[model samples]
Target: MNIREGKKEYLDMQIPEELHQRMNDVIKLDRKRRNERKVICMIKRTMASAAACLVIFAAGLNTSAAFAETAAGLPVIGGLARVLTVRSYHASEGDINLDMEVPAIENTSGDAAFTEAVNQEIEKIVNDYTAQAEQEFTAYKEAFFATGGTEEEWNGRQMDILVDYEVKYQKDPVLSLELTAAKGWVAASEERHYYNLDVASGRELTLSDVLGDDWKNIANEEIDRQIKERIAADPSASFFGYGDNELTEAKFTSVSEDTEFYLNAEGDVVIVFPKYEIAPGYMGILEFTIQD
Candidate 1:
C-alpha cells in the first residue's frame, strides 16, 4: 500500500483514544530503551540472549521476545507482552474522575491456568478499586456538606482514580508485571501489586530462585551495606534508620520471601519497595540491586 492509502486507512480505522495514548506510550518507551535495531513490519522470532533464559526455557515463552516485540509494534495490539488493553474505561464527571486499563495477555509462555489466574486477579483488582474510589468520593462529598462546606468551595475540586499495569521485565517466558491502583482525593491512597512469573513453569518467581537459597540474608546484608555506604559518603543522604527519619518502625529490614522485585536488562535482581515502606514518602519508591 502507498503512503496515501495507508494514511487513509489509518484515518478510517476506529480506535479508542485511551488505547491510542497507551500505544504511544509503549512506542516511546521502546524507542528510549532499545538502541537502533531494524524494526520491520513483518513478524519474526528472536532467541533470549541471556544465560538465565536458557536455564529457564530449555529447562517459558510457550511467546518469545521477538514475537512480543513485533506484535507490540503493530498498531492494533499496541503494548508489551502481547498485553492488550481489553478494557479501557474513562470518565470526566465533575470531581469524579476515573481512568483504568484492563490488560489481557495473548499467547503467553505460561500455561492456560497461569494466564487465566493473572487475568482474573487483575480484573478483580481494577473492579474492586474502582468501586471503592467511587464510594470514597461520595462519602467525602457528603461529609463536606454536613460539615458546612459550601457547594461553591467543592465545585471545582477533583481527584484522580487510576488502575493500570505495566510489564517491568519481559524476557522470553519470564515476565515481571505490576498492577497499581491510586486515588488522590484524601490521604493519598495508593496500592501496588507485583507478579514475577516463570511463565514456562507457570510458577511465581521467588527470591530464592533469583538469589539462591540464602537470598534473604544476601539481600539484607547488601541493602544495609549499601545504605551505610551512602550515608557515610554523604551526610545529607537520608534513609530511614541510616539517616534522619521520623518513623522509627520504618527501618530497612530483611527482605520478605515475597518482596516485590524485577529482573533488569542484565538479568540482575532489583528489589523494589513502595513509597514510605522503608523511607519517607518524599523518597518515593526505592530499589536495591543485588550485586554479583
Candidate 2:
C-alpha cells in the first residue's frame, strides 16, 4: 500500500469536534514531554510509527468516519473515557526484532487512582513481555552457537515478536480493545488479550456482562458447531480436537470470563483463538462469530 496516500486520506477525513480537541491535547502533552527528555521523544516516535500503521489501514479500509478515527489509534473519548497508545518500543538484534505498542487511558469515569492503577498494570505487562523476548533471543543465540551454526547462518534464521492493538468495536458505553502478540521463527504462534470496558463506570467487562451466567456453555456449544461446520465445508481444515483419528467431541467445551472476544462491525460477538490454540499455525488467528 502507498503509505503516503493512506496518510493523506487519514488527514482529510473529518473528525468529531471533541475528538479533534482531544488529539490536540495529546499532541501538546507529547511535545511538552519530549522537550523535557530526549528519551521520551524516542518513545513517542516509536508509538507514532505503530499508530501510523493503524491509521493507514483504517484509511485503506475506507469505513465510516467514526470507525476510521477510532481505528487510527486516536484516543476515543467518552464511554471508556479515552484509550490510546501511550508508548511503543522496537529493537532489532541478531536474528530477532521486537515491536510492541502499549496502551493507556485518561479521563476515565473511574477515580484518578483507578486510572493510575490501570496504567501501571499495562506498563507491567509490556515490560514483562519485552524482557521475556530479550531472554528468548539470548537463549536462541546461545543454542545456535552450540549447534555449530556460524553468525551468518544464524542471521539468516530471522525471527520476530510483534505486539499490536486493534479497536474492534466502539459505541457509547462500550468499547473493545484487542491486543495481539505474535512470534515467528521455526513456527508461528499468537496470543490475544482483550479488554471490554464499560465507559460510564470505567469497569473492564467480563463475559457475564454480555453472555450472562450460562455464557460458557453457550459459547462452547456455538464454537463446537461452527468448528464442525467449517471442517465439513473444507476437508483440509484441521482443528486440535477434530481429525481423522482425533477425539471429535474434545472440541471447545468451556469459556472463561476473560475469554478473548470483541464485536465485529456487524455487531456480532467474535471469539478469537490464538495460533495453534484450536487449529494449525497456518490458520494464524482464528475467529468465530456467535450470532445473536
After superposing candidate 2 on the true structure, give the runs of residues whose Cα lies further than 4 Å from its correct spot.
1-76, 89-98, 156-159, 185-188, 199-202, 240-245, 280-284
List the lowest-lDDT window of 10 residues for candidate 2: 37-46
Residue lDDT tens for model 2, 233-273? 99888887776627446455577765677666565667877
lDDT of 1: 0.62
Tens-place lDDT digits, model 1, residues 5-109: 688778889887899899999877644333211100111112332233344333232346765454545343222235667788898777778777666655333
- Backbone clashes, each candidate: 1, 1
Clashing pairs in 1: 62-109
Name the candidate that leads on lDDT: 1
